[model samples]
Target: MPRARPPLVTVADVRAALWSLVSTAAGLGVAIALVDGVHATNPWSVLLAALVVGVGDALLRAPLRRLARAGGAVGALVLGLGAQVLVVWAALTFLPGITSTSWTAVLAVLVVAGVVMACGHWVLGARDNAYVVGDLLRRARRAAGLPRAALRTAAGPDGAGDDGSGPAADERPAGVLVVMLDGVARPTLEHALQAGLAPTLDRWLGSGSHRLESWWARVPCTTPASTLGLLHGTTDAVPAFRWWSRRLGRMVVTNRPADAAAVERGASDGRGLLADGGVAVSTMFSGDAPTSLLVMSRASEGLGPGQLFVRFFASPFVLVRAVAGTVGETLKELYQGWQQVVRGVRPRVSRRGWYPVLRAVTNVLLRDLNTALVAEQLVRGAPVVCVDLVDYDEIAHHAGPLRPEALRALEGLDRVLGLWEEIARGAPRRYRVVVVSDHGQSLGDTFEQVVGRSFGDEVRRLLRERPPARDVAPRGAASRRGRSDGEAWGPANTALHALRPGRAGEGRVLVGPDRDVPPGPPAEGASATPPAAQPEVAVIGSGNLGMVWFCREPRRLGAAEVALRWPALVPGLLASPAVGLVVVHDDEGPVAHGPGGTHHLASGLVSGRDPLAGYGSRARADLVRVAGLEDAGDLVVVSAVGPLGRVHALEELVGSHGGLGGAQCEALLLYPDDLVVPDDERDDVDGTRMLVGAEAVHRRLVGWLAQLGLREGA
Candidate 1:
């Protein structure tokens, strides 16, 4: 855990002091110009008053914030705006710019200053990011946990390139920074680079300092599965993002903290990508890193909005900047969504209800926080640092992956990458930066929108059944809202969940939670789970992939038995134009049935039309791998892929992933040019050698660590 930051007047302190001085000066100037509340003896008195006000806040604000956080309904990570206002009031009362006798006039200045300053920052548009960027960079040096006295540097926020005169190097191995830009495909990144959206990376690649290679994100192409392989070097993590854990008799949605921990325990065996000495930031799994920030699996580590993260968040104008960004981003989403509807953009999902808010939080707040935490570790010379930037992935889910809003979010992620690059210049030891994506998103209309009903509803229609008592996915929107539950560990309410006075232990993953939980167990199966005690079959997943599980069966049901039971369910699903294939375990092994023919997996026999036709060359192998997992569903359904690379998502996302279709599996890896790949792990794809599967990518990453002398071997 990161220790409490010591009190010192450092770079961040100076910059914050400066920004406050300016903002407060502006506020006091407005009061002196427009009101009779403040009287200045001389011109310098306004500046003096601003500095005095900053000092007052510096002294009294924290205590008032603590009191409010402890005494009221306000969350721990709340802005403490009231406390700040109080400090401003108290400071102005004693300053030459204000009279202590006029409380009403003081109140007038407070409201006017608050509104005007907030408006000023908001209208500053993109320039407003300076607040977060400068604040984080300032805190980065101090947060690195290295000595401050000798850490003089020419490379920093205001400058670049190390001066070779700083803190003495420790006798430790060089480090690697592995960054994941979630749901960004290889092609998308190429487009971004070409469009000059990611100038730094483009320059690096052009300068021959980096090599961008295409990779594959295999079947069950979801964050949980890919994250597991990337962090733990294991492929058989949970069967899907949400799965029935037979051992634990509960539905495991890896997005949930406790469930994430369970999945990590099942996959990890002591050593992981960051196991030696590193940090994991804003990722699903910890990679066995000694320090984990915003990692779901390590919720017990208990950093959250507690003192450590709060100090970083509570820094002057950091939260205000985020709040302003959040508001602007939310409005942008609303306007964009409205424009999409008005312009009749096809294959779009509704960005209504809580989506706009979620998008703003993910893109603005989480992105900034994750960047800050990762930058801190880099400056500290950590052996391995892994971080995830979900800005693109989150927005692309609602807005189409190629839409302007989503691409704009992608551009912001690129800027963050550039910031990290800039920060890396001053590190004590040399570091190789490797950037990759967990999975890519495919765009199209949702399955429900296409068919005018959900897969669950379709299954129920075929089987003459009603909704299960407590199904994880409801009959509505296949893009179940629960996937947005990020992590319990953060600095704000959106970021941190454990803020309630007595409910700190029960972290809030709630905004619009329709968590994927299973139906009640069958009366017969001893090892089955049900949310409310009603036994029934379930059709889950809201992406391109859908899974059918029979709660009545203790073990997975075979194709022959399923045909014997609900004979119409299989044939009914196969009949839908939205469905491409129905995969089920057969007597001869797993069999895939398409509209035209059947493909037998075990012997690679095609009775007629090959079921894996347009899905891609790797579809068969990917399906074979997923179908063979221990907890795979009784039947797997994949939406049809159109010639235009369009897919019908099982859930309610305009852009989606989780099965074979389009660019969803087309991931990328941008690594340092010096890293070499062995011949055996490379597979030829379209005449270019590409790394296949998440496990293969993991091996390559491990090799890089060994090559850097951070670990024993690849």
Candidate 2:
């Protein structure tokens, strides 16, 4: 039998094709204006050139898209540029009016064309374009009987809801979706919205459906701690991002998969916010979610083919768009870094090295991945979804938190939020979107820059210096003077010697044990020097917060013992104007010593200006509470706030956190106005009233889920 004639293209297809053509033509016109050698001469000539280029693009679109998809984003960008160059060459060779000087000029034209195309895509809604393609691909796959199964199902405590069947579209329960924009402060976001950098967020706030409220992050405000608290409703023993774990016998970096898993185990109580069939994307912890993507806690497990990856890679153009987008973003980061240098923007850290590439990956590739995965979850009718985007946090770390580059990151996130809102409207279940941040960042110069030495170096100097006269006196005499000279004579003294082996003035203080430590029994006990006192003093910096551990000691020492061993240590730290508050375990309990001030946490007594005064009301409580954690440092050092609110970071970060001061603790939460806050109690901090702690934020989110009848009981 003869084959039936192919069906005619629909009106919608024709309209889409025309729109694509117009967009390409407009982009070509822009390229023509930008390239030096290319001369349009007149509006007619420009129009003619655009038409030729657009026709050529349309003719080769299918093959080019296939090639681009295979090559990924970077490859596609290169291919597109090459193709554009060839088209321009053909146009200049055949057209009468269009002219170019040389091949170099053609290359420039192609570059400009690529940039224009990218800009056009961004302006005309890039995510929307991807969404349309993804939706079509999904529908096509479903129709082919290759339906993608939902990765997880909601199960009540008794497993009553464990059936594989999904809720019908209309019968689907209301869901809550939380988007955590890491490291964005409430004030910073407010300024961005006022400055028109974040129009989408501004619109959301103005729509009356959402309300913007500021809350306080717990002490040692950081991603790992705040995220853990937000997800599991407890920060607990997570004192800092990286710390000396006595139990692990090594430093624990929170981003490391093993350490993250361990930390989550310590903090999670099995009933995380996403415990019941929720989805977590790009988060530090999985929140005990059944479906998780790029979660640090589960990163050790080999990633498998899943719905998110399937949906993300379904469209050939998505990968190409991501690559092209990353390239453009990388160029922008370089330009922004250069501009900062030219403008002599102070308090800015070096933006060289792999940072530009990292920023591109974060702002483009990772962002696209998160957005696609979240969209997939929404489509699959997840009960609750939580996604953390680190684009702003990564940028704000090197660049000042409020710099243009960081603000641009915020704008990009706002665009993603808009996309999610659009997707949620047609989702199987009604979703109430909430935007929150793990913690805010404080901008400042690093302590090393201001003090001419790192916190570790200074501490080493104190350890190397000869003990005070009282410390060197006879043990009985020292005891009479209320000093325990034991630290100077015991294993701590051996650690000091190990730390400064080549005499006090010759070698730098040992930050950690020598990497070349002899293997296997130290060569038959060849004068084994007490295992060389590995990490005599562990000084880990979490933003502006500094944690110092006297590692040689078997157990944590109090302030008196520390003073007796290294008398100049506390004095030296306090001498530096950059040092803010130093909290240590004293005989009386945890005592916070600030510049010319001291506060006894146990008694709630202040000797000088209340050290925790401007740090917020919960600051004292939070600091004391964190100090008591088993993993907390022997002495916790917080950077002093300058007159302009800048805090000196312990690390080499310009924008710092992990301690109180300024916007570091001031996080924001944007939720639907109809959602009820769990506590709603005002925390008065130095006369400023606000919500305190990520734990409260967690409760509020859980309450929202409960209110939607998604939980076991409302």
Candidate 3:
């Protein structure tokens, strides 16, 4: 398994190369004309200068990347500002026919070269994703210096299905790449394919190289819950992205390292989807993967440091382009927000402050870095690799699902798919590319906007009392972040949110509850600590889903108990036009209540108007399962879904999930067709499947892997 031959130059490659040459010359000509004492003797000397610069860049970039990674983000900043110029100056010095009298002359050349490279890459790189992917993979492979034995697995012999005695999975070297496109609804995905927003995906489907299918993202439809099931075969693993864990007596936000680690400890069994030589990238949990990068749960162990900014800014061209893009995107957001204000775009959130910068980072730098990381994983010859691309999700949170910016994020992600597709063709082992979504986003006005108060405020209003409650942060987290944790991830959500006036509900803390009570009892999900002071109830919202739990009770308070404790609360919410349905776990079972009637989940007993109506046929069943969870809220409140398919999000997000309604439950999966039943043998089977829960999706994914000669254990 010697290193594979380099791909032959194609028209695209030739075009890029030609553009590079022309841009270099253009920059050099400017430098010669503008600099005080800079000259190239002949036209050939100019060509030599450009060639030498390319060689200098090639020689310096790897070390620069190393230096950037070692220096962390500060190193990347230094490299972006001056390292490319150093390479340019060094390259200029090599030409015997060229002359630079002073350091200023060299500086002028260096600056011009920097501008040229950045501009050239931006213009060309926008057209291609494979170039970046290939370069990253080559470098990762070169950096690895893997063992000779592992290198032999690159072209391992193909084997048949496991019969019984022989281990076919061990003998075979086929792999699977699962790409989770965050918050992409099936309806939106089809819209993107048809509207030419996702050209690469459209091409694949149109050419019949792939098949598209939709799956139902179940109760508490969210990335944390969905990914938990997919990776670890654990349904009901997470109650919600953010939930009240009475057992811990602290707020559990899955994205936080300690919280994620705690949840993973409870859920993973070492035989997860990634148990066998798998790699996890940019995920909440590692799924027992031997190697995990940018995974929240593994971060506690110092697995993958926050080196994305460092690695990304190491390239001066990328840094300059990204900086420009960030500014442009910031302006675009300001314009778009103003446009929305004037035009009155239905169901949009406030887009202001650091969000624009955050948006640019997620949409540009983060995406590029994540793709590079995945390419590195592929080069490492891992059996399985799963990565989450969150560009669209972040945009849609504020812009709404169908907005131009959100859709554009989808288009950029399509290029990422193309990169992975190309990588699979020459991977160390036979690989199949499959795209999935943890959940989908639902478009909506926020509950506060519709209901005239935030969910917390509403709860307080209903209680008619301001019971003292303390802010309970996670064990390792500060009670107050002030937007700076001061680590590799020191300047993330904390710093960003600190700049803006904190919103009542969400749009504030990105993790954990704003208020919580001390531990109640030692039994049944309660912490060991004794309660000092307790809030009457803890109210937390995940998108459209709102959870209310009585702080004094270790167990879920039943419907009767809820009614007894706060008689006016459920009735008052129902009378309000903003409320849709309120679900409560009864002594008998989970029951749904509406403005008109009550529907028991276990018995299908409808007393008045069926509350779950318009929510879909599966809503009752999903509720039944969610209600059974140990940390299930005492009362689950869902905001009204408007006539136009809008569910009012309990959080500040415009396009949100973690509740049933609209397209939030509908997830799209785009996978290679040949792998899932042979192309010739199967019918044109591209449609939606009723994957009732994330658990079902987990089974389906494991089955797909089994078809690829992988073990079906997970």
Top-scoring candidate (lDDT): 1
User: Tens digit of lDDT per residue, candidate 2, span 541-652?
Assistant: 7777888876556678999999998888887898887888899988889999987889998899999877776665677788888898888999998888876778988766
What is the per-residue lDDT of model 3 for residues 1-714, given as tens digits with 9 covering 90 to 100?
A: 344344454444455556656667666766676777788777777777776665665676666666665544444556745665675566567677777777777876766555555455567665444434545434333322322233223311121112211112233368888888988998999988888988767866775657887777777888778888888888666777666776676556555455566678888888888887788887767878877766766554443432444445444344444544556566777788788879988877777755666677667656766777787667656789998787888888788899888898898898887666544444555566788898888898787778776676777678767644553322211222111111112113322222232331132234332322222331235465554554556676777877877766767778887788788889988887767888887778888899999998899989988888788767877788887788888888888887777898776678888888889988877776655623332222124235556676776677777777676443
Q: List the residue pairs that clash in candidate 2.
A: 73-323, 580-640, 617-685
**Reference-based lDDT, each prediction:** 0.69, 0.67, 0.66
Instruction: Estimate, for each residue in 350-417, the C-alpha lDDT of model 1 and write its tens digit.
Output: 77876788788888777777776676677667878899888888888878888888888877887787
Best by TM-score: 1
TM-score of each model, in listed order: 0.84, 0.73, 0.80
Question: Which ten-residue region of model 3 has the weakest summed lDDT?
Answer: 479-488
The positional error of residue 470 in candidate 2, measured at the CA in angstroms, is 30
Query: Which lDDT value does model 1 have at 535?
Result: 41
For all the candidates, what are their Cα RMSDs to the real structure?
5.9, 12.5, 7.9
Residue-level lDDT for 53 in candidate 2: 69
